[model samples]
Target: MSGIYIHIPFCKQACHYCDFHFSTSLKKKDEMVLALAKEIELRKNEFENDVVETIYFGGGTPSILEISDIKLLIDTVYSNYKVVGNPEITIEANPDDLSPSLSFRRNLFEELKAIGVNRLSIGIQSFFEDDLQLMNRAHNADEAKRCLEFATQYFDNISIDLIYGMPNMSNEKWLQNIETALSFNVPHISSYALTVEPKTALKKLIQTGKIDEPKDEVAQEHFQVLVDKLSENGFIHYELSNFGKENYFSKNNSAYWLGKKYIGIGPSAHSFNGTSRSWNISNNSIYLKSIAENKLPSETEILSKNDRYNEYVMTGLRTIWGISLDKVEKEFGTDFLEYLLKQSEKFIADDLLYLDEKILKPTSKGKFLCDGIASDLFLLNLE
Candidate 1:
């Protein structure tokens, strides 16, 4: 099945740890919206024979847009593509944008539901004031709690994001963050370690001693806590960093992990069609100009057999669906399968990975290190 992702490249303010393509200014928002719609129409031919199953609104902050604008984009998708019956439409939101009182003017949640937007992924990085300040989030701790309380009333398929392993954050505080998020009863929770990306304000702060670097050991401890607590709460650790109740897993993200084809619209968004991948320009102005000229404005890369194998191994090991030895043999031939077995031998011996029948899956102890393991198994393209 195929899906579509629309990136809204704008945010109220830049988070210290964020490096995503977004402009804090709203000067070109109107133009950007029209350009996004035109791009959707322009690229409709790519998915002419495919049925769109999920429409995900991700990025800098989709909630900042007007309700009408959000609806217009969804409408544009419908006009150009063959959408599935009751497609899983999701919008990534920031807590500050959600109304404190649902009865407020225009009622954002109600309007979104009216336009077929069924899911809300709120970016509730932390529930503590200190953590919020450290991350330079626009919303305070109160907004994070209040938004979820109001959101749960309108949307059943709700997901909230939390950041763990912050500098000076105790294990108790990290657990409290998860507990607070659980208290809201969101069906899905996506948590990640506070990483210091190169060139991000966070990296600068750490280098200047303004903020301490996030410890990897602390992140490992928090991940364990997250998995245990969510499992106790009846949420499945379906992927490395995602926990969701049965039947509430994110269709959009799951599709990506399963190697399903999807269209990514908007600046800096990436698209994949099985063998090839493309990404739009990160520059907002350039993306708009290109689309205005009726061009796709993206670079493409055709995947080699080795490239495909490595990707499958990486994505597969990160999810509940691990790499299938049988499928690898069938698709990539016996030589690749033999190489996979040889590469995974050390991990298997260490109990980091185990074979369930012919499917190779990561063990509980190895889940956090899956990415590293996957990388080691990658076949360097010498051809």
Candidate 2:
């Protein structure tokens, strides 16, 4: 089974810490939507052997779209692609866009479900007004709570996104957010420690002395809190930033962690087949103009074996599943596999890694510093 990811690069307002590709202006929403529809048609033939199992609409905020726009995009995928029956279709929505009495919102969910969107990933970064305002998020605490209540009727497979480690957030408040999500019985929760990315508003605020820079100590403490709280609630820490109860793990994201092939469409969107990776240009107008001319608007890269192995190490080491030496030997050859084991020996001795049979996995103590550990294991040069 394969997956499809469509990027809807538009948002009503920019969050302070967000550096994702998006525009606050809606001038080209219609044009971009149309372009995305056509782009889906152009790339459908690329997934030759697999039936599409998951379709994720991710971006600045997919919830902001009109029902007609969503339907048009969905129709294009169905017409051009061999989408599997009962595909796990997901749309990333924001809380402010959901309203209980809005017929448009209700119909949007119904129509999307009718067209096979079975999951909803709502961007409810925080449920506290102060925290929400601090991050310049569009939704208030009340709307964030109500959105989930409104969504529960139509969709059971729901996930909420939360952020921690903002300057205004305290440990007590951070844990409270986790409690609130659990109280609502959310099946999946993706929590992340806030980082001020360069070129984002938060970064500028820090540079200008408008706000204090985020403390890494605070973020590290909160990360542990998240792990403890979620684990206590029976949510598996499946990936570095994801927690899911039972079988509610994100199939689309899991495809990425397992190095599965998927198509990505829209400006700044990324796609991967087994051998190569490609991404659309981040500029909006360029994407619209090119797709209108029936031209594909993406840059491609073919992966060398070493490049692919490093990617495998980067993605695999972050998960609950440890890197398997046997799989490495089979796929990457005995020499590369031996090199991986030799490199892992130091971290293993330092209690940062654990090996069972032939599989090497990170210990919980090693997870926080996983990036450093993974980077050290990369082959300087590989054939």
Candidate 3:
């Protein structure tokens, strides 16, 4: 099974730490929506033989659009692509858009359910006012609580995103954030450390000494707190940054980790088959103009054997499905397998990684350093 990712490249306001491609202005929103629908139809044959199991709407903020606009995009996909009978449909929403009055929220929730949206990934970031201000989020702490309360009444499968390890975020504050998220009874939580992307406002502030840089040790501490608390609460640390209860794991992201084929539509979106990957233009106007001219403005790259092997190791090490030596030998031949085993000896000796039968997994101490270990295990070239 395959998946489809729809990128909505617009937001109500810019978050200080965000580096995702988006426009705060809605001047071209209508045109962009039409372009997205056209692009879906234009690329329909790419997944002709595969049935779509998940349809994910992710972006600057998908909740900004009207339900009708969302339905239009969903209908376009249905008309052009072969989808499963009960596909998992998810939309990423910000708290501000979902913090309307009770009546309005009920109507919105019903409309979404009627249109086949089975899951909601809410961006709550934090429950403290200071943390929200630090991130320059549009929603206040009260709105964050209110939206989740209203959402729980209507949706059973909900996930919330939280940010930890801010510049001044103390351990107490981080624990409070975790407890508040737990109070919401969300089945899934996707949390990440606050990284200062190069061009984001957070980086500029740090460079200018207006704000202190985030500490790696502090982030490592926060990550452990997150893992421990979530596990204590019966959540599975299925991925490095994701925790879910029972069957609530994100099917869309899991498919990606497994290296399944998916078609990404809209500006700044990415698509991957087994051997190649492609990304669309990031500019909104340029994407619209190109679609109007019946052209796909994108770039594609063919993956070499080393590139594929390195990617497999990186994604595998981060998830519960650790790297498989037998699969490596089967897919990349015995030479690749031998190289992987040889390079893994040091880490294995150091207790950072362990072997269970033919599968290799990261130890508890190695979880935070999985990416670095995966990099060390990479074959730079076939030579």
**Candidate that scores best on lDDT:** 3
- Kindly provide the TM-score of model 2 when superposed on the true structure, using C-alpha atoms: 0.97
Provide the RMSD of all predictions against the true structure, rounded to 1 decimal. 1.1, 1.4, 0.8
Candidate 3 overall lDDT versus native: 0.94
Order of models, best TM-score first = 3, 1, 2
Q: In order, how many clashes per candidate? A: 0, 0, 0
Off by over 4 Å in 2: 100-105
Q: Give TM-scores for every candidate, taking all chains together and pairing residue i with residue i.
A: 0.98, 0.97, 0.99
Q: For candidate 1, lDDT tens digit of each residue in 140-172?
A: 998888888888888899999999889998889
Each candidate: what lDDT? 0.92, 0.88, 0.94
User: Candidate 2: deviation at residue 260, Å?
Assistant: 0.9
User: Model 3, residue 195: displacement in angstroms?
Assistant: 0.4
